[model samples]
Target: MSDTAHEDPELIQLLTPEGELREHPDYPLDLSHEEMRGLYRDLVLVRRIDTEAVALQRVGELGLWASLLGQEAAQVGSGRALRSNDMAFPSYRDHGVAWCRGVDHKALLALYRGVTNGGWDPAEHGFHLYTIVIGTQALHATGYAMGIQRDGAVGEDGSAVITYFGDGATSQGDTNEAFNYAAVNNAPVVFFCQNNQWAISEPLERQSRVPIYRRAAGFGFPGVRLDGNDVFASLAVTRSALQHAREGQGPTLIEAFTYRMGAHTTNDDPTRYRVSAELEEWRLKDPIARLHAFLTREGIADEAFLKGVEAEAEELGESVRRDCRELPEPDPLDIFHEVYAEPHVHIDRQRAEFADYLASFEDAGAEGGR
Candidate 1:
C-alpha cells in the first residue's frame, strides 16, 4: 500500500493540519468546548508520561521503554470512548490508553523497571496487562468477545471489547486467526490497528500489498481508515465501531493511519533505517500541535488554559521520575507467587527446592563469617 494512505480521499478526518474542522457523513463528532479542552489536556499529559519514561530508560532507571511519542491522539481518543464495562487488550506501548482507563501512571514504570511482570490487576481497570507478544492480544480479545456473545451480552447496554495492536501485527498468523474467528462468530469486538508507518524500521510496504483496513473486507466485515493524528476522528470512529458491535453488528476494523516519530523502543535506533526528512515531515502534522492550534483558533481555550496544561505536564513528569526511582525492587521468590492461582504438586516441590538452595547459601555465609 502507498504510504500516502493518510491522504486518501476516503480516509475520515475531522480536523485538518491547519486546524480546520471537516464533516464526515458517517462519523460525526459533537463535542462541547470543555470536552475539546479535556482532549487537549489528555494529549499533553500522555506525551509527558511517554517522555518521562524515555528519560528514565536513558538514565538506566528503566530497562527499556516503548515511546508512544506521536500516537497520543490515537490512544487517548479511543481510550476515552470506552465505557466502564468495556474491556481493552493493549500492546506494550498503549500507556496513553492506560491513563484514560484510570490506571496509575507510575504503575507503568514498574514493568520497564523489571519490578513486575504486570503492574496492576487487569480486572481493576478493565484493561488487560500489556501483551508483549505481538498480535497475541488480538486472539485473546476475540476469545473474550466470543465469551460475551455466549453470555448473551449483545444489546444497547451490552459490553464490547477493543484490541489495540500495531501495523506489524497484521502479518502475524494470530491476528489473521482472530479476524477469522471474530467474523465467523460475529463477536462484539473492534480491531484497532495503529498503522504508524514504520513497524520498527520495516516500512508498511513490507507488511501488506494493500491498505491494512482493506484486509478486513476479505474477512467479511466493514473497515474504515481514519487520520490517526486527529483526535476528533479517532474518537468518533471508535465510538461508532463499538456501538455497532454492541448492537449485534459484529466486528469492525479501524486502521489508524499515523506515524511513529521516535524509535520503536529505547533499544532500537530509527536513525539507522529511516531518514531525517521523513521524521521532519511527520513533525509538521504533530497530533498535539494541531489540536492546540484548533483550540486557539476557535477561542475554545485561552493562553492561560494552555499554560496551565503545560504546568500540569511538568508536574506529572517530576512525579513519575520520583516515584519510579522510589519503587522497591521485588524479591526473587515473588516470581513463584504470581505463577498460578491454585497450588500444584510440581510447583510446590520446585518452590521448596529453591528455598532450600537459598538457605544453603545463607548458612555457608554465616559459617564463613564465624
Candidate 2:
C-alpha cells in the first residue's frame, strides 16, 4: 500500500468477511440483539424487493430498472445508520435506502414505469427524489445540509446529510464541487460512494489511480474504506460517520469496497466485459449469507428464524411484483404540472399546443369535448 493510503484516517470496522467480530477504535456500535436482528431483517426484505423488481422488468412491466443485488449491505447498513431527522439524497439504484426511509415500494416502481417523475414528496420521508443524473444529488445534499446549519435545526451536536453516487459518478465535476462546498463551508454531510467495481463497462481502475477513500483527504476531510460485503462493517462505519457529521465535524467520505454481482441493469450484460471468475469470487462473500452464518454461529439467531425471514421475503417479493404490475399509467396532462410555479405565456402556449396534439389523436367528433 502507498504511504498516502496508510496516512489517511478511517473509521474502525467491527466484522471481517470471515464473519468474525473485530474491534475498531474510532467506531463501535452499541447495538442490542434486537437491533442487530432488525438490521438483518431490513437487508433481507429489501433484497427480496430488489429481486422482484428485476423480475418485473423481465416480464415487461418496467421501462428500465437498476438492481441493488450485491449492494444490500451497503444500502441497508448505511440507511439504518441514519436518524429519522437526518435527510438523504440517493441515486435511482438506492431503492434499499428508500425502503429504509419509509418509502413505499410501489412509489419506486413509478419511476421505472415512466408514470411519474417521482411520486413521493421529499419533505415527507427525508428522502429526495431518485436522481438518474449521477452525482447531482451530492450538491443537493450539501445545500440541504447548509440549510440545516442555517435553520438552527442542527443542535450543538450537529445534523447530518448522506448522499449516494456510483463509481462512475466520482469522475463528474459536480461531485468534486460538492466535496469543496461541503469541506469549505463545514457542512454536516456524508458523501457515501458505492464503488461497485464497474461503472457500467468501465472498471474502477479507469476511474481512480488510488483508492477512492484517499480522495477525501485532498478535499480536507476524513475518509474510510469498509468491507462493503460485511453488513456489520458498513453499518458501524456509516453510523460513526453520521455521528461525526452531526457533531459539527464536517463531511466524511465512505468508499464502500463492493462489487456489482449482477448486470448493471437489465439492459446490460456483464459477460461482454468481465470474466466469470471475478463474479464467482464475490459470490462467496454474499453479505446476507455471511451475516446469517454469523448470527447462527454466535447464537444470536437460528434456523427457525432464518426460515421465517425467508418466508417473509417471499411474501414481500410477491407484493412488489403484484403492485408493480398494477401501477397506473401516468395522466398525459401531468407532463406540464410541475415545470413552473407560475404560468408564462410561452409555457401556456406550449401546453395548449400539446393538448391540441393529444386531441388530434381522438376522433374528429370527440376531439371538441376534450
Candidate 3:
C-alpha cells in the first residue's frame, strides 16, 4: 500500500457496492426477517413519495422540493435506529427520515406548498420541523440533547437524539459549535452527516482537504464513515452510534458516503454545474437496486415478492399524490395563532383589525349584490 493510502482516514463500511454483506465486529444487528422487510418497505415508500413530491412541484402545486432521491438508505437507516422517545433535528431535505419518524406525507407538503413553515408539531413526532438555515438544526439538536441530560433521559433505556445535516453544513460555524457543545457536555446525540458528494454545485473536495469523519477526533468524539448506498452498512453504523450515545458515551459523528442523483431542489438546474458522466457513475451504485439484488440472490426474496413490493410502492405513490393534492391550504388566520405562548394586546388588536378588513370586503360584496 502507498504511504498516502495508509494516511487516509478510516471508513467503517460493512456492505459493498456489489451487494455483499460484510460483518462488523462492533456493530451488528439482530434483525428479524420481519424487521428487515419493514426497513425495505420504508425505503420503497419514501422514494415513491419523493418522486410524487417532485412531480407535484413540476405541476406548480409546490413551490419547491428538496429531493431525497439518492440518500434514502442513509436517512432511513439512521432514522429507524432511534427509539420512539428520542428526538430528531432535520434539515429541509429529510422527508425520508421524517417518514420513518411516523410523520404523515401531507404534513411535509406545507413548507414546499407555501402554506406554512411547518404544519405538524415537532414534539408530537419526536422530529423537529425542517430547518432551512444550514447548520442551525445541529445546534438545536445539541441543545436538546443537553436538555435531555438535565432531565435524566440518558441512562438505562433513556433516549438519544439524532441530527441530520449535509456536507456543506460542516463548514458552518453553528455546526462546529454544536460539535464542541455536544462533546464537552457529553450530550447524548448523534450527528449524521450524509456526505452525498456535493453540496449543491460544489464538489466534496471543495469542502475540505481531510475526510469529514476525521473532524470528530478534533471534537473529542469517535466518528465513522459508511457506504450510504449500502442500507445494511448504514443501519448497522447508525444503530451502533445511537446505542453508544444512549449508553452515556457522548456524541458520535456518522458520515454516510453517498451521492446526490438529483438536483438540490426543483428550482436548481444541476446540469449547469455538474457533468452527466459523474451522475452516470453513481447510478451504478443505486442503493435500492443493490439491496434488491442482495435479497433476491440470497433467496431471501424472489420475483413474486419483488413484484408485490413494486405494486405496494406504486399504491403508496398514488396515495401520496392524492393526499398531497387534497391537503387544505392553511387558513390565513393561522399566522397569528401560534406565534407566542401568551397573547399580547398588540397582536390581538392586529388580528382583530385584519379580520375587520376581511369583513369590510365581504360587506362591500353584499352591497354590490343588493
Candidate 4:
C-alpha cells in the first residue's frame, strides 16, 4: 500500500535509514557494544562476498550469481538468531545466511564455478544446499520440522527450522502446501519470506494485493512484517518466531520488507524491467550502510576496527578469486558416484553405459582431427 517499507505502519524497524536508533516494545533487543560492532562487520563482509561473486560472473568464471546486496541485514540477523541444532533451508540468493552458519566463502564460489553441486555438508552446518528449484525448500523444511517433532525435540530450547523464499514464490503450490501441512501438524518451522519488492521482473503489487505477511492468517499461523533493512529488528523478531515454533506453537511467517538492489541473477538485466530512480531510492536504505552509520555514530567501532574489517574483506575477496580458479574441474561421471547408500545393479549398469558413451566422444574427437 505504501511506496517504501519505512512508510508501512505494520513494518517494525529498530534502526532508521538515516542511522538513528529506535525501540520496539514487542521486539526488544539489547545488543552489547561488541555485538553491535559484530553485526556491522557481518553486513560489510557479506556485501564484499557478493561483490566478488558478481565480478566473477562478469569475467566468465562463474556460471551465474544471485546477489544479496541490499538484503544482508535480513539474512544475517535471522541466521544469527538460530541455535546450533536449528536447520536453515535457503534459496540460491541466501549466501549471507550460509556465511553466518560458518560455511566457507570459497565453497560458495566453487558451486557457481561449476566445480561442485554444493561444497558444504548440510548435516554438519545445519544449512541445506542452495535450492535452485524455487519454493521446494519450503516443503523440505516442513518435512524436516515434522521429523524434529517426532524426535521429541519440541520443547524449551529445542531446535527449529527456518526456510527462505522470495515474494513471487508465495504463489507456488509447493510453498502453500507446506504451510498447510506445517500448520495442521504443528511442525517447528519458520517460513522466512524476503519480500524484496520484486520477483524478478514482477513487482509485489502484481503478485498479492495485501502484504505477504497477512497471507499467514489464512494458513492458521501468526505473521509479522518487519523492516528487512534493519538488522536489529530482523534479529529480534526471528528469535521470537523460532522460539515460538520450537515450543510447539506451530509455524510463523516473517516477511522481510526489503529491496533487491541488483539483478535477480547474473543472466538477468534489471535495467530492462526497472528504472534508475527506483534503485536510487532503495540505495538510501542499504543494510550495510545503515548499520555502519549506527556503529560509527555510537562510537562502537573505531577507525582501526573499521579498517580491519575492510582489510579482511579484501583478503577474503582475493582468496575467493584465487581459489575459485583453482577449484578442481569436475568429472562428468562424478554424478554417478553417490546415487545410493548401497550399490544397485541398475545404477552400476547405468554408470557403465554412461562411461562407454563418454569414451565414444574421445574416439570421435581423434578420428575427426585425423
Best by TM-score: 1
Scored by lDDT, the top model is 1
Kindly indicate the candidate among 1 and 4 with the higher lDDT: 1
Better of 1 and 4 by TM-score: 1
Residue by residue across 1-370, what tens digits does model 4's lDDT show? 3458678888899999988898888888978989888888898889989999999999999999999989999999999898999999999999989989999988898888888855789999999999989899999999999999999987887899999999999999999999999999999999999998889999888999898999999999999999999999999999999999998899999999999999999899999989899999889998888888888898888999999999999998898888878889988888887668799899999989999999999999999999
lDDT of 4 at 71: 93
The Cα local distance difference test for each model comes to 0.92, 0.85, 0.85, 0.91
User: Which 10 consecutive residues of model 3 have the lowest summed lDDT?
Assistant: 1-10
TM for every model, in the order presented, reads 0.97, 0.92, 0.94, 0.96
For 178-215, candidate 3 gives per-residue lDDT tens digits of 99999999999999999987898898888988788889
Off by over 4 Å in 2: 1-12, 156-158, 341-349, 365-370
Error of 4 at 306 (Å): 0.5
- Score residue 242 of candidate 4 by CA lDDT: 95
Collision count for each candidate, in order: 0, 1, 0, 0
Q: Tell me the TM-score of model 2.
A: 0.92
Report lDDT (Cα) of residue 62, candidate 3. Answer: 90
Residue 195 error, candidate 2, Å: 1.0
Model 2 gets an lDDT of 0.85
- Residue-level lDDT for 58 in candidate 4: 98
Q: What would the per-residue lDDT of candidate 2 be over residues 144-221, giving only the tens digit for each residue?
A: 999898887775455689999998999999999999999999899999998898999998888899888889999999
